[model samples]
Target: MTSTAREAELLPAEDAATYAEWFACLAEPTRVRLLQAVAVAGSKSVGELTEQLGISQSTCSHHVRKLAEVGFVALNKQGTTTRVSINPACCTGLPHAADAVMGVLAPRPCCPDNLACDVTVRPLEAGDWSAVRRIYAEGIATGNATFETEVPTRRALESKWLPGHRWVAELEGEIAGWAAASQVSNRTCYAGVAETSVYVGDAFRERGVGKALLHKQVTAADTDGLWTLQTSIFPENRASLALHHSAGFRTVGFRERIAKHRGIWRDTVLLERRRSVESPE
Candidate 1:
């Protein structure tokens, strides 16, 4: 009907009808704003959405219904309030929108070119703890990696890496990053879940060392039958957050004032990635 809608119809056809519906649903400025709000707030009820966006209840309900009609949202009645969540299927299909939005917003890649540094990822060994500890300590000294007061000894660090779950990144024979999974909880019920930790040397930050280590660690953990991998990250750690997000972890929730650091309370965000027997492409 509209030029934009016609253009959307002519675009590639991975899911033509679905994309048409999504395009029609998103064509409205109000609806686009509403979806942006929901993406930022995770989920919201009609009343909450209205209050936040300064729209009337009927208007908010109308836009939400349009979103649901296009399969972009799901509504659950919670007594007098209705809760809405972004449909995972639709959310996963939104990369086109993301790219378009980025074209207008960022317009430039954050890291356009890769570093020329030589790096390698391999199975971590017991003998590597000294180098690992030193790298980790350097990260700690910069206040960017961990909250641990002191670096662990070789035995202490080795005890944490369970069989079938160890990987490290090396740069010119020096350990740059390491990642391993530990039992999520002492309780047996949580045995299938494990919490993962990754640390990269300060000198190797943003050089792809963390990404390499995560790929190897996640692959090993998945092969070992770990169903869920989790981590707690300080809210201020943007690089670590980007690494986990790129590796497919989703932010589940946040804990307020979970730890005290540098004489101030710090919040931690919880992130998790579900691993299946099938490897990721």
Candidate 2:
């Protein structure tokens, strides 16, 4: 066992008093292993857990039962197999559990070595057209963002983006990402609403570029008196979902087969961030 595993074993004892049942349940090596497996799989059945961990079916069931007893795992009957998944509430309440577990299991950040570059959020500039085109080109190639046929020309895009609420993220003095809000509908009734979009260069993604762009767009829209800003994100794009949620966007609906890409239909989720009831001065 590595030092981390050894530490995991002993650390639970410190909180044993308040979490006696949980600690005691996790004390068993087999139960701990089962919990780890379930956490990794998101949700798993008894048989699937046994196969993944290379443990006996009966032993897997026993350890899973222990985990469930302590509230670390929840079991659901799925036909002949029992499906088990981590109880997020239980793990979240246990101090340091998330950090310790994720440190050992989660993938490292993509841009871990690039500390010198800082992402900057600011209003879009007059000459940011080239950078905006480059960002849009990258997003277009990915096939996950936007339905535009090709990167819009600088003059055309700037005419549309510059006049309305917009923001861009600069990385090391280069425009790496951009987001903007446009009127949702031309009718005067929808004047207080806008649809928002964000695009980031592939190289700068997962480096806080998207969030920075989104922050600027949201702030700019709020400042411009847009009461509600909305966006539709592809269901598979987890990063976009996280960005919108962090920016206070609430999921309002899901549209199935709203768009097609590469001969397949894509489902888009609608999200909106409303200006707080308290107005921005």
Candidate 3:
């Protein structure tokens, strides 16, 4: 490993104290169980937790207190009764803390270097829309892509996606996959942040099309001054998640019951990749 990797593997001294506190809070199995129960049930009264956990009211309350002290759970008091809920922020913060300590979120390459030479990734062109939309339809049919039951029109996508950031991967002169970034917000403060999307054609499934498209997409975003790129993917889409991870994305957290798809509620894993400051513009 390089010196940079060595430095990243060692959790910084300033962060060690706080990370230790968070870990120590869950050192007890009962405390860990208490946090999990509250997290799953949303918000529950102490009595509800006690009965579900099969512990005495005092024991439940004691563990809850410990979790609350570490900012894992938030307690709301109401007329002699207290309801405990998992902190929404901690859902993402805890995982980020773990990644930081383990060095999984350390600075990495701007994009994958070993890209398939035969697959050509280039900026979107007028002729690429048909193929791109077709690939997107394939992803939607899988029922794990997005909540939208129908593919958006090319005009709609053109308006939403950043012009220079849109790209398509071609194999043997045929579009195999496409990737693009959409601005997350119109506000000036968030101009540097974007939400990304990538879809690969059915025929191109294991040919590194997804990887090539992501490498081009992320590298373009980083060079264009975009500091943050994020995406929410279905938990069942393991291939997409693995592709993004290889491109430097880290799991920030999981959003449970984020939306409904085909009349059934679905959850999504939120992942993000922040541009490394050391990377050249």
List where candidate 3 sits over 4 angstroms from the true fold: 1-8, 13-21, 33-94
* Alpha-carbon deviation at 229 in model 2, angstroms: 0.4
What lDDT score is found at residue 131 in candidate 2? 82
- Candidate order by TM-score, decreasing, is 3, 1, 2
Q: Give me the candidate number with maximum lDDT.
A: 3
**Tens-digit lDDT track for model 1 on 74-135?**
89999999987777776667765554433322222212234335878788886887777887
**The 10-residue segment with the lowest total lDDT in model 1:** 103-112
Residue-by-residue lDDT tens digits, candidate 3, 1-281? 58877766677787888888999998999888888888898899999999998999999999899899989999999999999999998888788788887778776775678888899999999988899899999999999888889999999999999989999998987999899999999999999999999999898888988889999888888789999999999999999898899899988789999999999999999999998887665
Model 2 bad stretches (over 4 Å): 1-117, 162-164
Full-model lDDT for every candidate? 0.75, 0.75, 0.89
TM-score of 2: 0.56
* Model 2 lDDT per residue over 13-118, tens place: 5554546666667778888788888777789888888888898999888888878876888999978878998898865665445334334222222112333248
lDDT of 3 at 124: 94
**Deviation in Å, model 3, residue 51 alpha carbon:** 10
Top-down lDDT ranking: 3, 1, 2
Backbone clashes in model 3, listed as residue pairs: none
Q: Give every collision pair in model 2.
A: none
